[model samples]
Target: MERKALFFLDECRTVISTSIKKVLAKVGSKPVMRVNIGFSSIYVILAINAWTGEVVVSLAKRPNSESVKYFLRYFKRRVGSGRVYMVMDNYSPHKTKGTLEVCRRKGIHPVFTPPYSPELNMAEAVFKSLKNYMSNKIFYTIEDVKNCIKQFFKENKYRFNLNAITYLGLDKIEV
Candidate 1:
């Protein structure tokens, strides 16, 4: 195990891009209201282990205490306690007493990124890079979108290892 901790965070998308169009893209002045298609948008909570460059992606609809609890439990069971550290962003549910308490009881120490610094969240960069890689690819249906994301993860898993080990604060294990 490495001396540094893993990083954790959750990503959720809403129809909120309508208002940010001007900032997010170069578009006409008229705001195009995006219709809510009522698809089951996923919330992904991911953990990146700094030692081995393993990226774990977990899906949820809501990021509440129970969801986080389950994520942590699954993580601990898979990785074991006291072997890895966790670096995380300060989301409310992540800061919940119940969640922190569970981490403490389970021997998983959680480190946090600095306030207002998304750059420190290397996982965010992974998503941004992947999306950019997928940009302008046409997909007519929701399943297409799902498959695109799946393919992105599959294609980048090894590249993710290289980046994670070199530039993303993860260190290679010395044998």
Candidate 2:
């Protein structure tokens, strides 16, 4: 049998600035946090290897079909030639004809999670970890957020155990 590469795919939007409603501080001293009222944000499209925990990330201005296609191309290039099975959510852009076409051209098979079942996608855990890593931190600009994301992944490339998190028993399957 031909080798198959399995990946969990997802996208998330990171805002440039976030406001924290609560914080731990000394008594009688109010904690001040810089918050950007502007809605400037960037979308991150990410894919993680189900067996190896390898990751591919892309920053996009918008979370649309075009961005999905672009990420698919980028993923293909990074992963090289292989039979890829990408498990993703049922986002509208993920099901668009253009995105499907790109997946077909790149030899990527999309396996979507059941409707409204984001928990089934292991990528959600990665995103949650990323959010926690960035929590209580201030980002001055979209670039700052982008740089932070890159640094986070770079410093913690093996932070996640895909086999354990996904409960997919990836290690038991022959690649």
Candidate 3:
């Protein structure tokens, strides 16, 4: 498979929060409704391959060093022995020496998005789309929300077009 480095980023704030605070606000008297276990405050990351516009969702938690390692390992297994390049924001975990060393050992090259440009990270757009799909829908348990997420990936992963991803600055990525 052809490999290309692409911008990456994480978004933790759920769309539900925006709707509750901005769009449809609760009226007076009744208890203010909060998004239940339906949505997580956890960070979700995507490692997008620019060449094919194929996105691999990583750990759905904080952007910590351990989480980055887990993602790298997952990526390594997915693309065994194929040298690959990845682009990501300069988040603290990404910059940590341990994280860099792990990537180096795994033959994964990391590129960074330009400073202060969120629009350039196509992975962020992926999460936004996921959030848009999840907004306001209540799930009795976290597993229910997870099933929805899994379904989304299964159904739409191949449908993502390179043209739209390029618009999100994915084509700008380089080795």
- In the range 79-102, model 1's lDDT, one tens digit per residue, is 765645677778778889999998
What is the lDDT of every predicted structure here?
0.63, 0.83, 0.65
Q: Which of the two candidates, 2 or 3, achieves a greater TM-score against the reference?
A: 2
What is the clash count for each candidate, in the order shown? 2, 0, 0
Q: Is candidate 1 or candidate 2 better by TM-score?
A: 2
Could you say which candidate leads in TM-score? 2
Q: List, residue by residue over 1-175, the lDDT tens digit for candidate 2.
A: 6446888899998887764545789999978877776588888799988767778989999999999999999999999997799998889999999999999989999998889987677778788888877777888788888998888888886446665333654557866
- Writing each residue's lDDT as its tens digit, candidate 3 over 73-106 gives 8778876775676777777888899989988998
Write down the worst ten-residue block by lDDT for model 3. 13-22
After TM-score superposition, the amount by which residue 13's alpha carbon in candidate 3 deviates from its true location, in angstroms, is: 5.0
TM-score of each: 0.66, 0.85, 0.73
Candidate 1's TM-score: 0.66
Error of 3 at 90 (Å): 1.0
lDDT of 3: 0.65
| Model 2 weakest 10-residue run by lDDT | 162-171
